[model samples]
Target: MNKHQTIEILLGLLGTLLIVFALGLYILNEPSRLEQAQGDILQAQLNDAMTLYAESCAVCHGLNGEGIGATPPLDSGALRTMPFDDLYKTIARGRFDTAMPAWSKDDGGPLSDYQIEELVALIQSGDWNETGDRVVNLGLAPLIPFTTDPDPVLVEAVGSLPDGATLQTAIGIYAAQCVACHGTDGLGTGIAPALNDPAVREKPADELTRTITYGNAGTLMAGWSNVLSPDDISAMVALIQRWDEVPTGVIPAPDVSIPTTAESIALGAELYSANCARCHGPEGQGRPIAPPINVKSFLSSTTDQALQQIITLGVPGTAMPAWGDRMTDAEIQAIVGFIRQWEATAPEVAQPLGQASGGGGPPWLRNAANATATANAATQPTATPTSASPSVAPSVAPSVAPSVAPYQPGAEAGTGQGGGPPWAQEQAQTSGSAPLDWRVLALAAAGLSVAFTLIASGISSLKKYR
Candidate 1:
């Protein structure tokens, strides 16, 4: 038999075993390689679809599907969560109320059902990282750029509030027409004016009413007169005025209170600085391109209902974009609270001269001043003014005679000839009067609080019933 034969056989067996082990290792790794290949294919398909989305949908949906005004965002949106059938139906049917045109012939647009399906898939299934447990970038989907060109007719139509409309109704109207440019917080963004500024708050009711009704010419502001009735204008003005009166240091709603939540107002402050400070300004002073938000006038004027509606629905025309699909209702509410909190804590600014006058200045100047005041009130001040004056006095006094001076015209041994303009004297008298009738404000606040409570209860009940 022989030792030589035994050794040869053993060597042969070891060689065979080594070859088998190498083959096993290759087999074990093959599935991962295949999976990688499959992922690459999916990513390529997604890239193609995203490219298509950019080319075909970006104009309306936004580059990131954040959606321009009127168009819905597709990124991790309701459409993404909706049943494919419903999604298909919406795309096919098109929303008549908005500019979202039907994509399928069945409804009216140019795309086919298959294309719609593909788009939906690309939006929903596109993973940010292929190798790392397929996590979807929910934030990425709704990152549509905000748009400003809302149809003037649409703005007017939506801004119109029927007589006796509730604050909620008024808010809904603003949401459809103002939130985009103004942001859900009423803090100005891009090319919009803040609705909460002291200057705006101080504007005469009539002037404010006129601005809302007629809108600023040659600007993104669209006249809502065609859509809103005079009564509606009055209601809106009333609302704005109310916001203007909110106390300078009021707190945010309880749910959004920084002390009680996982996310602090401090965090919100950081977020605002990063995401909102540029357009809104560090102190929320309305920039030339934006508006202020921290003034008492703005907070007092806007109701919570209105704030929520604006956050959810957004303004249709103009640069304001809808965030309904981008942020959760809770998140939006938190943001609203954050802005309100800012209004409460932010330093106050004086109203502008023209705004204090009630009516005699250029419309644009008035609008700008008002918008600035409103926007500034909501962004916590990076640098608050050392002294808060009620008004920003004009640099140059008017050339009116001493007799016409608003404060003191002439003084001859207290003959009263030294007193300022009659109107100025009257204003002084009023200013010297007792502080605001807190009892009356309290009563109004109580009444509004009750009304809101009831409404909330009813809504809760309805949800339960459903």
Candidate 2:
């Protein structure tokens, strides 16, 4: 063969080998590649679902699906083993008369069908460890639970009952686990049915046991089989049955009164205004950024210790910050004291200015208002326009510049102050979704490189033939 023909033959052979190699590689890796792609899609779905769960569900269900208060755990084995369709329906339509609201858009919820599916998949197969890690990375860790001892007066009251020992044990169990939804003495709250009612007392012993063990389906009442021993549940059931024998005054009001002098309250007032008023409202009325602390229900239900602890540790996954690191214990106590003073006169229900959740408020406004207020308070007389005063304005201007620039009507989007407009800000905040896997990108780059090599060889061969 001629040298050109030989060259052409060599190029053809090389191209053939390359093609064969690629085909063989693909054939060999097809199953794994498909699995990886599916996995990537699942991961993306999980990330999206995690965001939704964090925003809407985590406040009650917990950041790690660990369950908070009376809410049941989502990461439990029972949910994992639940049929996909059943779980999907539960999320879509919600459990009847429960806190688990219908999430699908069809049922007047915010989620679409696809979103609901993603959440179902996440619950069934997603890694809770990964979910927890992501939440922590995003600084949305679950709140530090209230760990204070039970109210001494309540403890003493229970201790003096007819069956003091059993009552004490049951009271301990109830206070530790059950009191969140079932109010003290099993009177029931907005969330759960009253155990002290005649209906519960009239139920068969076996039925009561089964209900406590297995929990009422499609309700917020979670089974105690996993959390409490059979004995503990029996004690709880016994406590419920004996409610008729127990007098009304047996369970006295919890004494959470902190010794707050007028001066301390005044200091707390100043501190609350300076730190908490922007979101919680100036008079403890609910604002869009926070729930009302001044509401009668809140003040009555929440003890002074709880209020202090909540302030100190802050609620996780919410905008409420942990003042433990920022303020002294005394300061937090003072703030709680200030909040406690509103109990007697607080309205039965709050007229919240916006949603009863925090973190949805315009952060820029809060920051700007605080900045402006501080600046105004600290404003000294301008030094008569001296050259030094020109520098002073420049120095002070930068401090306020970032806060002021974003609010201007004509400011460029995402250019000056607070990252962008409020909508843009939300978009920016939520832009950290899972990205394409590196392996996929690598494969694409490799394919391009191979194609480029083939094209170059083909062009050279054509030139040689000409």
Best by TM-score: 2
lDDT of 1: 0.47
Please provide TM-scores, in order, for all candidate models, with all chains considered together: 0.27, 0.37
Q: Cα RMSD to native, each candidate?
A: 30.0, 18.2
lDDT for 261 (candidate 1)? 30
Residues 1-466 of candidate 2 have per-residue lDDT tens digits of 6776676567666656666666666677778766776876776688778766654565467667888756798999999999999999999877764545667666656778998899998899887766654443222333322112345575576667777677667667776666544544554432345566776778887888898776665444656676678888788777787766554423322433554645456657877978897777777765545665666656776666456546755655679886655554445556777898888788765533323335344765445434433342243123112222223221221121112111122322212343433433544444443333544555565566567667766787788789
In model 1, which runs have C-alpha deviations exceeding 4 angstroms? 1-4, 84-98, 102-118, 127-466
- lDDT digits (tens) for residues 44-101 of candidate 1: 5565455445334544565455556556667656655778787767666555544454
TM-score of 2: 0.37
Pick out the ten consecutive residues of candidate 2 with the lowest summed lDDT: 398-407
lDDT of 2: 0.60
